[model samples]
Target: MRRSLAALAALLVAFSALTVGRADAADAVITDFGVQAGESDRVQTVALQRAIDETSAGGGGRLTVPEGEFRTGALDLKAGVELHLAEGAVLLGSDDIADFPIRQTRIEGKVQPWVPAVLNAKGLSGVRVTGPGTLDGDGKPYWTAFWKRRAENRKCTNLEVHRPRLMYFESCDDVEVIDLNLRNSGFWNLHVYKCAGVRIEGVSIRAPHGDPPRITGDDQPWDEVSIDRAPSSDGIDVDSCQSVVIRDCVISVGDDCIALKGTKGPRAMEDEASPPVENILIEGCDFQSGHGVMTCGSEATIVRNVVVRDCKVGPGVPVCRLKLRPDTPQRYENLLFDGLTLDGAQSLFDVKPWRQFYDPQGMAPPKSEVRNVVLRNITGSLRSLGDLRGNRGDSIENVTLSNIELITDRGDLRVGEVVGLRYVGVVINGDEIEAPDSE
Candidate 1:
């Protein structure tokens, strides 16, 4: 048979030339002696920190940020470095927030403060920030000093507004951020605390859509329009770490594209009964910025097997968000959102128990809990007016809905209590939404 198909095409070209020579021998080409493109940000941050401390003093590799605009100021990634940014590169920053200082670390995941960011990395193990270039923080005066410290304390937290986090990985393990494109930040673009085997692939995050990044001289043009909700400028903030995986990304930020938090306020149930953020996985993503693409608790602490399937949501954010925080004894059970597709959102399954921005004399009244959730095969054509409220002493239980096809303008579904809801073969608006054969 033609010599067995030419020996299986020469063994797939010798395994693609040994996987491109082991990725060019684990890479380390810092523009051949560093600091080149329109130089002198103090000589390219001192020749890129002397080629990342001489490639971690001869051990680790992959630092290559080749292409263009490379301004600097604060960049301290090491321990087997990996910051590859080719293809029209631009790792610009240095709008000077005292060049990002003040670090004790672990912001959302309680450790008493953190600030040093503009790309900070600690305890890294095989770290990586892949290409398709652009990690610009350049955050308009740290988002105008974080809304002037929330116009002076709107129950401050998120480390009292001392910004800078477009990427901050600490206690890292096999971490990987692939196909990058992160923009305008001052806070939360990606802040994986207490990391584990993490992988955020095919990324493309862009902030500011529909007025939220304005706190300019507040004279009430609606208070100078401060829509950039400066409290976790989210796109990704999965704190209290675990084995995470966010795939096929394309987020549009103003806040929450993926937010499951933990650790804060009155000791967050001893940090959720000891490091409890289980196997999380989000699939085929695409949400044009801000508000629930896969959320849980406003400051989540105990989350379990979360799996969000094939997604693609667009138009005026605010869909499928479960941010129940009645004071924080958090627990969200094995959640799952399967094959989803919503175009033009304004609402669709928003479970709320968020204590109106909690601050009951410094919090302590939330015995948080969201049970086994599952929303299967949902196909929406929504436009607005939706609400699936829950919180009459907590219980958004074993929610299961199969083959759902909704066409909304507001109607077809709304319940906070249907004994924790469930429906198979639900086809709203075409009529067929039943599920009570037993709980």
Candidate 2:
């Protein structure tokens, strides 16, 4: 156990952020339970589930999946069981929606009946999913179906088409997800909801990158076709979760790379189930080709005390993005982004209203507030500078940018209705704007 903790510190971080499950010993192996390594029309998850159940039912330990290409439906991860995939192992999600049973899970900020993720965990503690392996969500079919639905109605929500994420942990504590290649997710790659003391480290998340072709025929082999923008395929969605440390992850996804989410509605601020997301630290991560490197909401109500530091943003990504919902009452404060090195990004800061698939439930729209936000020590070159705008009744106060040096392609910066905004040692496009000049 001492050796295991030492190794974990080396792999995840030099300083330990959180302590997870004890999975040093393997008590069961999936292949030992007559599980084959290929495709089948029937749900192949039965053997795997049996192994997990037997191992966890008795005193819990690690359950190993050996090196092979295994296909399965949805699976439930029990408490005290660590699903460790060996090197060269590949766990593929079945394309059949029927294989995934409908379960009550959170999607897009609401808890409703949806397809469970490839791996699900609920109301458990000391859970860990780690190993140098791959979890592939054969997601092209879902993407094709989503585009088709959008074409017909143009207003269909993401939940209209059932898509499964790679992994989902709900109401779990002391979780650690590390050292896995999670790709081609039908929806968000990793969704952590209401889970505390979570540490996500050294995982690689990739989504479809091909150019999206037009959806002309339903009978066409949509799976074989190319779709660059995977619908709702965010890399990491931390929903109403706290005490999370996301470090050393490499993310290149179609949607936002790291998005903070909470419930969204006129009365979202009063929603007890979806509490405020606070005390998060995101550090030493790499982002590429995502919508926003570090973003907050299309479905956030209250999020505070978040710090993103020492991250790198590749080209075509926005460093910071805030999606303020006009229909929901939001309070996002005490957020800080520091020591970010960006290269050729789209913009430094992008904050605007997000109204897609927004329904007010016929109630009066509520106002939002953003305060005590800071972005410091950010060195980057971006296409455009920023567009930070607030809603008419919204309040944005006490925002500061310090030690920022950047060369911009276009100096089109727009700021509106911000009180107590300040900049220190900021240079944009060879122009310096210090304390008194940038008030």
Candidate 3:
């Protein structure tokens, strides 16, 4: 919601001030190419791929997907072509992993030979996919298999199982995906890697959250069993990208609502494949529930210049979560969270060293830094303000909190290894905790 009309008017003014389009990218229809509606055959895949290829070869236009359930395998979206889903259309992913061909693509932090996404665009300049419709991942089978494998081996990575994402853009520029409902992704919902000038707007991304019921492999009833979580179903993963704008999105998923990532470890410093993720603007979005509203790094080296403003967040969403990995030399700086309204969450600022599976490969724990951050003009109620603790020899520097009025239900805010943590016009409950010398 933009809130009540009066509040919405104010929000619109704020939204317009906060700062962050589609072209006529559908000219042709998939059904026109003899694609039968509601068909899951290889014929559907061929027809769709042929349509995309022919459209691109014909100097680029939009290939429209009309109203129907069209199941297909991996699709390589090429230059100068757009996949436009009509109002009632559904581009469903196939259940068989064999349908998605394995390619040398970037997954998580590493670039390896993995399955291509349901819709993949690589090494192109102009890529687009718009929808008032849906891109369904149909991911229950993948979810069940991943959960089963994790049961056997406690040390299973996300890509160890063959799971395909809904959409992936890699090594491309000027990408746009707008107004699409992306749901139930086998891995991440929308992933952009090593790309620039990307715009993702008005998208609704969702997967199951919490211990919701799941259909087991035994063909159990949907409501009979409960799984822990949708394993690694992140909403949007912006890995090593720059100059991106994500606006007016509604996201709720099993993992992070939106994450900023890069390559991990000291080796990533000289690695040219994955660069730092920077110059991002996120505004006017709604994060219903996830691990965090915006998280930086479980795998990262440098993430900078991110601004998240004018968003509405529901419960169980950390406002800003920074996962500082001891094994990786991470530097997260120049982040700003402003003009937000939140219902309730566990932490408003949750920054802790992520030591899960800490393998530095004989390298010592590298020094990391989180600096030049600000959180202001936020009105919210949460369990705690946050737990901000940098590791030993690491630094959390120059964080400013201003006009942040919150009603916290939990214990006091924790702080350590922080330098120049400033507070201005801050009100918690009925008390005003202002520094004597404010900067």
Indicate which candidate wins on TM-score.
Answer: 2
* lDDT of candidate 1 at residue 119, scale 0 to 100: 76
Better of 1 and 2 by TM-score: 2
Per-prediction count of colliding residue pairs? Answer: 11, 0, 1
Clashes of 2: 0
Writing each residue's lDDT as its tens digit, candidate 3 over 148-186 gives: 676556688777899999999989988889889998888
**Top candidate when judged by lDDT against the true structure:** 2
What stretches of model 2 exceed 4 Å from their correct place? Answer: 1-24, 38-43, 217-224, 434-439
Error of 1 at 223 (Å): 52
- TM-score of predicted model 1? 0.33
User: How high is the CA lDDT of each candidate model?
Assistant: 0.70, 0.83, 0.82
Ordered list by TM-score, greatest first: 2, 3, 1
Models 1 onward score TM values of 0.33, 0.92, 0.90
lDDT winner, 1 or 2:
2
Per-residue error for 112 in candidate 2, Å, reads 0.9
lDDT of 2 at 427: 92
User: What pairs collide in candidate 3?
Assistant: 25-62
Question: Model 1 lDDT vs. the true structure?
Answer: 0.70
Model 2 poorest ten-residue lDDT run: 1-10
**Candidate 2, after superposition: displacement of residue 64 in Å?**
1.1
Cα lDDT tens digits, model 1, 1-439, are 2342344335334323321111343566666665776652542666777788788778767878888787776678887767789998888777777666676876655565556667778787767788888888767666766666665565665566577878877778778889899987777888887787788889998876454443434463443444544445688887777878788899988778888777645467765323776676777889975777877657676877777778888876666687766566677776767788888766666776676456545754655566667677878776642555555566555666778887776554556553556678877668775754322
